[model samples]
Target: MRKTTYLLPALVVAIVVVLSSIFVVDEREKALVLQFGQIKAVKEEPGLAFKIPLIQEVVRYDDRILSLDTQTIEVTPSDDRRLVVDAFARYRIADVVQFRQAVGVGGIRVAEDRLSGILNAQIREVLGADQVTSDRILSKDRGELMIRIRDSARVQARSLGLDVVDVRLKQTNLPQRNLEATFDRMKAEREREAADEIARGNEAAQRVRALADRTVVETLSVADRDANVIRGEADAERNRIFADAYGADPEFFAFYRSLQAYETSLKGDNSTMVMTPDSQFFEYFKNELSTNGSVTLPDPVARAEAPDAPAPDAPEAPEMPEPFNLTPVDPAPVDPAPESPEAVDPTPEAVDPAPAPEAPEADTPPADN
Candidate 1:
């Protein structure tokens, strides 16, 4: 009985000592001792910690930084633009007592919900308003709007006994439905610009073609005028040369012209020309017809005997040299005895002057009267 009593007392002392001594706490967690629903101690340091065994309860909570990510929500601005917003936050518990009171072990999810609401409210208020729409933030100025939003979210997240260290926004973009409209508008603008360029090119081409036509016309006209002037000058020079030749020898010119005409007109035709026997133009034909024909000039005396008048039956010859005319000599009187210086005998025949024996009367008997 004495052995049992000593053992019970010793065991009771050992239990008391164990309950009053330390409990281990990790760096990642905070330990709280609770007695009768009241906080008796809190251990924020690492290593061993003491607590009452049955009278006090130890509750450890994560003291490390944590993250809360919210679901995307449709945010509408005053301009009626709606977009999905995704946001996240990082926090750690600072006041373990307050954390326990505000957000119990299972109530952290609820607390996160409350924090999300606060973050959303602040984001909306700073970045947007019900009556006004703006991406600009006033507290952090216009350029640093995103920074201010994150900072403001962190500050506002503390109300739920949670500290927010970082807040981030991942993506913000137009929805699929708006993309096609934007592309269509861009295409329309490009088409307009292309059309304008084409129109200008056509205008330039028209101007060039017009200029070419005008140049062609002017060049052709100038060439035609030059040709006409040159032709006229050539014709005038030809006429002058011909006139000078004719003026120099009209008769010769006429002969040449007649020969040219005969060459041109009589060569191919089958007509024969006839003329009188003694025609000047018949000389060639007559000479050709006679076997012994010879071309010779007429005797001068004969030409004088027959002054060749233009015969109506004769074919005319072009102007040719005229034949010379000659006179017929009187028959010389037998030279009557050499005309013996006889002019002295001018008396009728001579026989000394008078008493010429007249042919006696014998011869007288005039024949029967």
Candidate 2:
């Protein structure tokens, strides 16, 4: 029983010692064995590793790629424009031994802090170069600038046993004051452009109006010329018609013209005129009067009481006596007639005193015949 108890305790002690001496290194981690706070061995591969128990310690470090985000920094470009820039860096430990030597107990946090400073410094150096401007930084050239930053940062990070893979600017912004000023300037430029466009539009409208006015004037002038030509043609046609009518019957035309003149002159009851009786305007009236004065008329009562006249086909009748064979006489002289009462009157008897003559007997033969 004593021997068994002694073997059990010894075995337990041996297991504890073995466990303390043996350590596991994961694939994702790099480990360093330290003795008296001094690095002794490094285990970069995975699986089991051995270290002296109670005297040696294992330090582990991440082997994978890491990210470092820098605080927002203000940088001035070559154009002297200030910008707020936020950036990040991708890095990995190229030499774990060197990394462990550089930051012994401070670990990844210390390495990251130091790396952030390096990144910020490089960013300022490359972005603030003489050829770099705010416009270039904000454009596709920004990629070139980032490359320069990464190159510069890699050189500085080598001392910290870090390999810089890339440096990139995440966000870029202008100061609030500058943003407002830029907006105001853009607005003013747009307004000026709008004013110029309006002025050009008005000029075009004026040209159109002038052209329309000219067209209207030309149209009216053409229409007037055509109208005058047509009117002259119409007048010539009317004059030709009048000439042909007059040539057909001059005497009848004259008589018709005189009648038209009388109708026109005596349109109303109050019509009056003062002219000599022998005026050519009264030629028809004078001829009628002369005929009435020269020929004697037969009484209507005597003609009714006489016997019926013979037919045109019967034999000739005997000659009439001398008293029945009345002849025409000359007209008497005219005296000055009253003005107001007679001139206004339209009675037929007042116009002429001699009665109308009767027709001759159809069956009787005349002396001249």
The model with the greatest lDDT is 2
Q: What stretches of model 1 exceed 4 Å from their correct place?
A: 1-21, 105-107, 130-143, 175-369
Q: Please give, for residues 28-51, the per-residue lDDT of candidate 1 as tens digits.
A: 999889888788888999998887
For candidate 2, lDDT tens digit of each residue in 288-323? 113346633322233223314321232233454433
TM-score result, candidate 2 = 0.60
Clashing pairs in 1: 22-49, 22-50, 23-49, 361-364
Best by TM-score: 2
Model 2: lowest-lDDT 10 consecutive positions: 340-349
Residue 2 miss distance in model 1 (angstroms): 7.4
Worst 10 residues of 1 by lDDT: 339-348
Pairs in steric clash, model 2: none
User: What's the TM-score of every candidate structure?
Assistant: 0.46, 0.60
